[model samples]
Target chain A: MNADEDAWERGSGVRVVPPVQPRKLAKVPFVEMADGRLQGVVSSGSDIARVYVSSITAGTHGFNCSTNNNRPCGGLGGSSPCKHLRSLVDEAVLQYGRERVARYLQIEVGEDDHLMEGLEGTRESAPAAVVFSRFLRHLAYLELPVTTEPVAEMHWFPATRAVI
Target chain B: MLGVQLAQLHDGDRPGVAEALDLVAGFDDALVHGFARLGEERAAALTALAGAVAASPLGPAVSEAADKVAAGSIGEEHLTALAGARTALLGAVHDALLDRLDTALGRTRAAWEESASTAAPADNLLSGSRSWLHELGITGWRGVDHDLVSSSGQTLEALLAEPRLRRLAVLLDGLAAELRASCPIATMARLPVRRWADLWTRAVLLSQPGARPAASVEPVTGRLLVLGADVHEHGTAVQVQVHGVLEPAGGAPTRLVRASVAAAKVDTIVGPAVWRLLAGHPVLLTALAERRSLDLADMPLSSSGDLAWQDDKATVGAPADPFATARLQLANANAPAVPPLERHPIRISEPVLLEDYETDGDRWTLDGHSIRVDLDRLPASGPLTPELVAASSACIGLVRWDAGGWRVQPLAVQATVKRKPVEAHTGDWAQGPTDPKVVKAEAKAGDAVAVLRERAGRLLRE
Candidate 1:
């Protein structure tokens, strides 16, 4: 949400989207399917200063949630993932896409299979260090000056071809 | 080399200018003996112009001609007239070249400057087309060469004044003028900037002799009334060029559209055999046989007129009448003057229709009326072309003004088979399924065409 600093400078709280979809395509600012886990950082809806580092482990379907300083999230002591992890999967579906996320998690998904519904796991405490660091790097990319030069990470993307 | 001499006319270096002048004079040096032998005093006119005649606009030209003649080169009769006259002729051509360049370059500069001043970003989707030229590999131009051939607004400031484009612009402008001069259709202006650049790019890549195997691509949009299709093998690649009336989308008038594709691009199509490619694309035979108008969306169109069989959706409809199309769409239609760069024999440079044309000895005549038929320029479609000429009295032929008159080369014949009227293209060009088994094969085809079609979708990705 801090990426909205430009909008704040422009005197708007955030870039406005027309009243269409109830949620943004990127509800969780960063998400990726990596290291046998569906992982990302989710901004805490209640606290402006906080974010939850979340992950759903592959095969075993184990899950974990924690803050930046390794404070275990209270919502981890439950059968279901907290709202932050749920929102992370929702945005992951919009980002890496549903089929990709399902496959990476080793789920033999059915048509209409909810990504989170296919996973059943117990409380798991995994270090949130790597995902939080990746989230910080993503924010750094957003701060880059607008340029025509190709972005190294986006070489395979179609829209980036022109900038090259 | 003449281009270099023209630029040197203003050079202060005497030896360089003199050498260039000698070359220019030498270009017509052979004409000296020929014209003098014919007893025309004009041959030696340039010889006596006085080497000091440096005050004339083509002063350096006069001084050079005189020096070449005076320095034991005969300050006299025959060589003088022709070289001197040739110098003047070159002067006039040089001036005309500047005029054409000024107009074209000025328009490009103005358009780009206007776009530069804009605040809000304007949607430039239909602003112009993009192309992929296959050289060592596919090299693309956003539009034009990004200089003289650049699309409006793509470049800024004096960037459009780059020398490469300006130099080629002269040659291309000359080519465009010659093509228009021979074209029978009333003169419209030259090709639009983007199309002109497309022609220029093709000219640079595939214009060489025996270079048919090389390929370049452009996209085809809108609907086209299919007239005919043919495939040719050029050692390295099999080429297909389609001729038809293109009704461009966004409500543009119907005009003749030529699109091509090379078989070499199809990595799976093993060799450059017509049958090998055609077997995979039986639809080419289907369209050539029956009148089929196709509406294409984002297809890889290459060369002069071949839209290579690719996975692009080509929705075909019936009632494909080439004759009726010529009448309504081509008759009185402004024939586009494109740079005749493609090696493909049937460039469809000037498409027109005729009825009850008169022929005597070798001359053919038409009313120059409307309601045109498929008229191919080369008439290289085998024996059937001449037969359509000798046997069928009424047929559409591509006409060009050459040797001081029009030449009608027939491509399609208007006749009656059984009780019904039939429009038949001269030769059997497309090779695929024939008889009732392959009648509607154009709408669908083998995997080769499907692969070619699907590649267009992923072309930009990889």
Candidate 2:
């Protein structure tokens, strides 16, 4: 076999997650892997001021899509995720990398598999205001002056327990 | 032969099959007079043995060997070869016989082909390969004889020109070599041949005469829910070292199953980094790219963590979340302290999935302790390492101790890119869309965080 082909086959078992399927990133401005789910902010496609907080966990694939004020997405009725939540995942993959998104979602990806395709769950509700607020807080951090000294606004420390 | 015997098994020929295998198995009675009297009785005994295992993959070779031995002039090794053929006919279900048979494969002349390989293909390679397999008298269990494994060495050597077959030869020899090596079989990169009969069914002689053995695995048992696996190239052979959790039947606590599976090629058609795993592995290679726990009732494992699984014993389970499963399974499991003098160890005992950790510069704060992240251990073949490490993120990683201190090889990561939380697994990290700002930020001579820190230092100087 050709060396290039050999290179292609050699140690190539681990796959590179293809770039997340092309989707409109602008529709979903903020995304993050947190709280054992993909939680993010997704702007309403029709309404200018409307934005929704969307989340879907890995194992349960339990999903939620609601406005910052807690109004539920009308598209949330059926078994499948509403478009807003789908948009949120698309952008999350873009920002975090597909494997990270899948890992956060707790799913293993297949070649040509849409990140959201493997998920199946009922539409559960969560506070959009909190997710939207986190997005705002995330934006707030970017505006702060960068310095080695910890800023008061960013003064958060993880609670620790000793490992024996 | 398996199809016939399996059908026979379905037909309730259990006792008959076992008896057929045992007939030749008791050859010491037939060979009382030794080589001088290796006349009709000896020839008939060898011939009967060949007939008894006619369903074996190596049956033709056994029959051929019997004929050659019957021609009146033969040594004691010929009788040993015939016995080996009979033993090969008996499946892995026979523990003692297969052990001796697998041990002898290393001494076979064809065993040397494992270390030597050529990129060249034989003339009429496909046809040649088909002929070579046919010449070996492979018919699954019907007639394939493992005892005669060395008899085909010369023929196999001639076909080493075929790269794929050559790879198979190397794999066979590799398995045999593992059996031969002084090191414990558990630590070997390859699985020990579980059954002498499997050699006949594996590779080109399977199902049909010349079809490749990609799936259609005959397994023993036990399955692992893959947490994560890295496909690494150590030398010539490739390895997919997997870390997974197995919840034993009957509500037992899930134990970690670390399998360093070997493979011949990346099965691109299946999923990302999914290996067309080396033949005879219990779990399906597709499991590497799946969230489902692999299906196998018996997974070949040693106390030291070496294992091989079969597809036959497999049944897919509910989807698994590697990080979550590891976190839950390894919770009370004490992280093994790095033994003194261990340096850059590839793996650690009692792997713990440290969750919700923050990465700052070279240090990662998890639970409470801040451990220095060792970048050097991050293999270069893994393209996602730098970004996964560079981005200040909430990380999930397998914690290990390096020469410096505790380090983590991130399995998945969630980072704020352009003020948004993004997630990734090492294998599929590139599948997500790239943030222009992150890319631009990385490209700039000085990164935003570094530039800011530098200005603060300049101000101190001023």
Candidate 1, superposed: residue stretches over 4 Å from native? A1-164, B1-220, B229-239, B262-285, B299-313, B332-334, B337-348, B367-383, B401-405, B415-423, B426-428, B433-462
Given candidate 2, what's the lDDT at residue B133?
37
* lDDT by residue (tens digit), candidate 1, B201-281: 333332122222223445667777765433332111233445677676787655555544323221122211133443444
Determine the iRMS, in angstroms, of model 1.
26.1
The CAPRI-style docking tier of model 2 reads incorrect
- The lDDT leader among the candidates is 2
B-chain TM-score for every candidate: 0.42, 0.39
- For residues B183-256, could you state the per-residue lDDT of candidate 2 as single tens digits? 22224232212122223223233112233212111223444666665433311134445666665555544455
Model 2 ranges with Cα > 4 A deviation:
A1-164, B1-223, B264-285, B332-350, B377-383, B392-394, B427-462
Residue A95 of model 1 has an lDDT of 48
| Model 2 / residue A113 / CA error / Å | 46
